[model samples]
Target: MRSKGERLRRRRSAGSRLSTGSASELQQYSELLHASPTNPYAPFDSKIDWEVARWAKLRGPGSNAMTELLKIEGVCDSLGLSFKDTDALNRMIDNLPGRPAFKREEVVIADEAFEVYHRDVIECIRALYGDPEFAKDLILLPERHYADADKTIRMYSDMHTGKWWWNTQKAVERETPGATIVPVIISSDKTQVTLFGNKTAYPIYMTIGNLPKEIRRKPSQGGHVLLGYLPTTRLEHIVNKASRRRTLANLFHSCVSRILRPLKKAGEFGVPMASGDGIYRRLHPIFATFVGDYPEQLLVTGIKTGECPKCPVPHNELGEYGDRDKLRDIEQVLNALSSITDGNPLVFVKACAAAGIKPVQHPFWEGLPYVDIFQTITPDILHQLYQGVMKHIISWVTKACGAAEVDARCRRFPPNHSIRLFTKGISTLSRVTGREHSQMCQILLGLVVDVCLPDGHSTATLIKAVRAILDFCYLAQYPAHTDETLNHLDEALQQFHQAKHIFVLLGIRSDFNIPKLHSLLHYIASIKCFGTTDNYNTEYTERLHIDFTKDAYRATNHKDEYPQMTKWLTRREKVLRHEKYIKWRVAGCPPPDVPQTDGMPDPRDLGSRPHLRMTRHPTVKAVPVSTVKLQYGAQFFEAAFARFVVQYHEPRWTAFQVEQAAANIYLPFQRLPVFHKIKFWIKDPFHRGLGSETSDAVHCSSIWA
Candidate 1:
């Protein structure tokens, strides 16, 4: 039997253990904690109430307690804790699972200086690997193919299952035997920090493709991490506009190169990193995809604006549909960039122009191995499809069919639970979102169905064109695809192109030189290489800006806010990680396993069958039938109710008999319960998981005659 002191010592040591590791590893962690006292999850006194610290930190930024840390002391004092001071609480908050610190660096590009706040990419990658939440779902090796019993390639659902990952995996294995490829996905967007301000933040986010798309796409899942904040400062110091643009482009590359410099060595050679499963694997992180809008894509790939970033398709020929020109060659681009080394600016400019690229020397991907910058630029559905092509289509349709007619048809259209009513029509609406465009797509073809086209230019062809484009948009977003679906996608685009000449003949537009329309040609290729469009959709990143940029900025004092924003993000991440850790401990620290279904039917598999729900309590209980006819505008209510009753009683009743019975039958009740509205929750096949719920009012009133 052990003595009381020995037992107490063992208990204290157990409490101090931060991770599930060997005694030597625990000692090493203890040493590291002591060495870096500011490290979150540092050792704390046994007497300190961790429950209080968890509550306080979990409040997150913009919380009342975050604004006033002193209030937490008061709460602790009320609880009569041993450590009730603000300083102790601060220490405890700092002692949660911490994030990598941001390093502020001054980057000078062509005599212009700017500040860039960034974290180490390798450190961030390792941190993600260490996360238990991510590790369980992480795909360490690429899935070559998943075939049915008949040996047919059936499912292409994730990036790992795509051709790019499989090909890249094979290449990496050939170079470094037994090496695992970690596909790094990068996204950046410039956003306003405040509602009314010149202040802006250019945030760059990074996530690995190892995680499942469902997890990667959700901001709440914590799959995405803030890689850095690029300088938003406009170079007002440079007098020449051309020079400024060149300098700005160079600065972007410079900053990105600095942030991702570590990956050069790490990608070529493997790094032994522990995954969420607590097993160390030799992982090689490589740049696989760059998710951005058109402008950002141009910036990353050094392509001039109004040019295709993925391929060498001429600007004039973008609208022409056939086989697209071959993809941009990296060797030719590098040679053009290298022209500057000869000390001839004119030669560099001409060479870059000949190569159809911006005059950007030493792009971010210059030294990165196995990274084709042009191919890495993924298709953006939100921008290119919905906002771009759909917007243009709507404008052309409005011109072909007058706005008044469109709006009139829109207003008169019957309301369905799933479709937007467009009460005032889409013509008057300004700054429509991708979501709105999608809603419009649902009814766009219907609105122009029977409408007369000016000059008798074949309204049937117009209808076909509109239908084809809508089909392409919906099909492009499928969560899984096969060869058959890819062919269908191709046919949809072909159908639209074949019918698009009506727009030109109608004088809506002279040519189809639109870049967004041309981008449609590459969808099949991109989907084959990178899986579904949802994997790299900018919609998820736009959602991320709310939490990572906007909320983080709001938490700050609004002066030199990047530092505070990064720190706040770090603290919030720590709090969340610690919460998970605590939960794991409580659950007996079960070994990490691949996520298994609970045998319940997948929410995605729930078909178009709508689930109807009505309030148990009636809106107006025992309302007189006369009031329903007069006030509720149900002129035929009494007759309709009688018919319903007759139908319900007599299954085989004739129509003539039902009408006669409805007119003569005496009503059972003078007053009846009425419900104002009913909700229909119907599954949207395009969107997986939770179905959409829309309400339809029950009224006899008609908006249209």
Candidate 2:
């Protein structure tokens, strides 16, 4: 066993050498933890109390090692094990050295215990096993900080965001097109006012971790990481338009400059960039911008457009772009924005000037890849669809739509037995938000022409047009239909434009004219060119900021918040790295299961279809027919057999359901019951695709005709 001082010295020495790639760093950290007989990095051990206590004291005041010892003792006692006697523990606690006074008392004393733990234990591990220059990379002292400044911040690098970008980039590159280099998608949004209690207004930008697989896939999963933040208080100081514009421009420039630094370095060095850069382009500039509201979009692009920002189409008030496909030119838009002059000073000049300590640039026009800017800065689906169009339409229909009684009107689809019967099941506008309204749109659009309205009359046609626009929000599940979906959406928007006068009858005019409503026409084109709405939307970015706001609020010290934030973020990285290391060590190749089935289900299948069954299992006498939808790991079963089994249940049910069922049953079930194990072969009569494939009774047991 080593003394506390000896371990500290060892960690400090080893920490310096951990400046390598993630794998090498992990290995080095693992080796350092194993250097001492009692590894501090490992799960808690009561036996190492003296060393642990001493380590805590090194962190700062307020960490009573005695409390930690007590916690360990309590855990041991709960497990019916004996802990070191209280007298011995007291002796150890009493002898522990006093907490060291780090220059900043406020920073050392965290508002929460987790902060303390992160600062003490996690940070020590990070310092020892992680990037040694993590803190140094963000903070600059002597030159930047005041003479008396205990802590000063130059910048903050969020570790989780970095890791996510790294991991996601790796996955995408490895799994998808290896040669294609996608630029980072940076999403910015103003968080809820007072989201951080006293720290009310924190507007932040984040790096999206993953790219959606295809046009239909939503890029909402895989948490986005923060790249930059601006406090509203800072904005309040720039009262005059010139100063305000300059300050905002500076803030945007500095933040973007930092983000682009790695890529820029890569460009200079002729090396692939850091944090998931590709060989093709060393500096993949900001190609996509996802923003919550219109103001942020204005800030990013520095210009408001009369037409859709994405396509070469002219904007129409009725949510339609006629046969004209003239997308706005990036250069033209940039010229328009740069043309604005305040007292002979061009806005561009003021924006790019180094008026403050840091230099500024037009983040979108100047900072972005020139060719990508046109489609890069477009409408966010979250605000445009749910919060914008859906919200507006619902509010209008329920409140001001020329219906005598809102409830009675929405509840009944206007008359004619010749038309489709409308389901009055949609809730009142007050009860549902934009997401729900989009879902309703999906259901309404799927109805047959006669079923959608009272008659094939003009009123019914108008209602159909309205629903069609909402239906456009849903990206088609299959790639083949995506283009068709976009075309249909365009046609629907055109029809809406032609018949928008119907909304006037419903007393909905001004609301229909919002740019987002018109911009919805471009989503299909975006998906066709870029990917899913998630690929460039701010949904994930906004959600991640909620957590960041909480973390920022925890650090009450605003004077040197950058240092505190770096520490917090680095600690988080160390924790995630440790977890990932453990996972890699423990994880084996995933047991062979089913190949993912793509595309829409075969159109031949009808409702209440018969079930398919599998024939074999190593453990069970007969595998369940329900297992046909699951991944088969049986050595006796061939890959073809596995695919056959999976396809039988999959097109009828979703691939998601099939995978989920595999996890639920195939992964856990030791053996299937005889009843579930019953197997048979079912053939499709409609398609005449005669197959000798197996079928299960268990799956179709519920679908008795």
Candidate 3:
């Protein structure tokens, strides 16, 4: 034997490491003893230490070298096995890896194949072959050799197969446009590498060495090697297409599933696909279909859509990494967290702390408590904060129209979160504050415009801010303010469009450009264009801060000037219904409560619906815009106001609003939103009588609904 071989031989026969038998006898016995448990030495009572020893001896000295023979005896016996044939000897050898370790082996990884060297791996195998039984039962996969230019070696194996795994029958499971296979999982890693695509067609080959000296020393070990090759590229093509055809709701339902892990509260939402990035990335393709375009950017998940910042930072330690892959900081932070949690956490308080992962004195920790009214904030705290922010913004705006302080506040707040909270405060307090449209527009304008667009933030982060702002505008009950906010918005939007177009245009990334942004923008334009005070015969729409209590509609009773609140609410109901219908069609089913209409039209495919044409509103008109419906809208609001006050017992809304409502919803010159327009009389509001007929006769409109 060569020097390395002699060292291994000397080490193996070290008497303390190997059994009393010669190497051949030891190998033979080890193999028999460790043979699949079904062939256990059924002659002894496993509970006896002597019986366990006898069984181990019976099993042979092959590779089943016993170190802590007693510890593993219980496990072996339960598995219907005697200790003679054991994996213990292999493990004991590994516990001492420094003995001539790293000697080159018959095991060589090259040319898409692995080899076992004559001197090393073979010697290890020879040591393992002391017993005939275990040796006969075990066989490493054959070497890979490409027989021709087109031929390639492929291999596969999985452990712990459950009922879901094998059918002896290989079949394709259908998801969107094609059939796919979800293969059985074989191992566990803290952060797993998930390979997406149809698992059935993808061959995953793994190799494990029967070496006794290696596994115990290296805990971060790979028992197997993985291949990134697939014979056909067809799996990629099919998976991509199927993902593109799915709806956001359905796509989420299809590819990824969330588990209520025992991490936080009653549970935490754990990403099931964490073990494999390939599987998680497939989620992006599905979201692409929802946007009607590829997403330019998307967070890794739980960043925007998840419940607050509630993820546990793992055992991490941060580093000052000069490289661009910024995860180094997170890694260090995780290690510190692990040290605190003692490597595992099962309860809520600890879970929350783990999720926050903040060191006791971190600066960001203080502001987190007041983040939202939804989680732990009491009603009192919520009310106080709401009032405080609104009042504070107003006082600041009044005192510092051009003050450097005002500009500084706007600049200091990141486009993320701080601005979103400001916007949410504005929207929530609109009914209470009675702030003027024009002044509100400018304040909002200032915030959106002040963010110095920097490569300093992720593009995904910027898009989130933009989306939040757009949603805030819509929810504030002020669709007509869009064009008014236009110039401000266009400038803000320019930052996102110009710099992000490259990725947004390509299908490669999916962090930016989701459906809600564009759809909400489009709706804002649609409603604002048609709903104006021109119909109310009021010219004050152009003013910055017309006090609502002092508007012309108060004197006019605004019946003739604004659209009815009843009409507007009725229209909103329709939009909701239409959205519901679109969701169903995409899911290839009917929405619940949807009556069989024999041939109810698909909402998303409604390209042929005949809508009454209203050409009166001039195209391209901006804020406080006028459309033909304004003429009839004034009359509409008068009727709507009378209707609203009587039916719902709602407070006397400012005449300013009554007039705006009339111009927006009731007139025939312009129809309400689509779902209502499509089946206006068909859908009934909860507990309300049929369509506008009864509403018209009673002079009652419902703002509450």
- Please provide, for model 1 over 25-49, each residue's C-alpha lDDT reduced to its tens digit, 9 standing for 90 to 100: 2223334446333423334332245
Give candidate 1 misplaced runs (Cα > 4 Å): 1-74, 81-88, 146-154, 591-674, 678-705
Stronger candidate by TM-score (1 vs 3): 1
lDDT of each: 0.77, 0.40, 0.26
Best prediction by TM-score:
1
Winning model by lDDT: 1
Task: Provide the lDDT at 276 for model 3.
Answer: 9
For every candidate, C-alpha RMSD to the true structure in Å: 10.2, 17.5, 31.8
Q: Per-residue alpha-carbon lDDT of model 3 for 106-168, expressed as tens digits? A: 211112222111112212222222212123222211112222344332111111011111111
User: Which runs in model 3 stand beyond 4 Å of their true positions?
Assistant: 1-328, 340-601, 611-705
Candidate 3, overall lDDT? 0.26
Candidate 3 residue 33 Cα shift, in angstroms, is 51
The stretch of ten residues in a row with the least summed lDDT in candidate 2 is 138-147
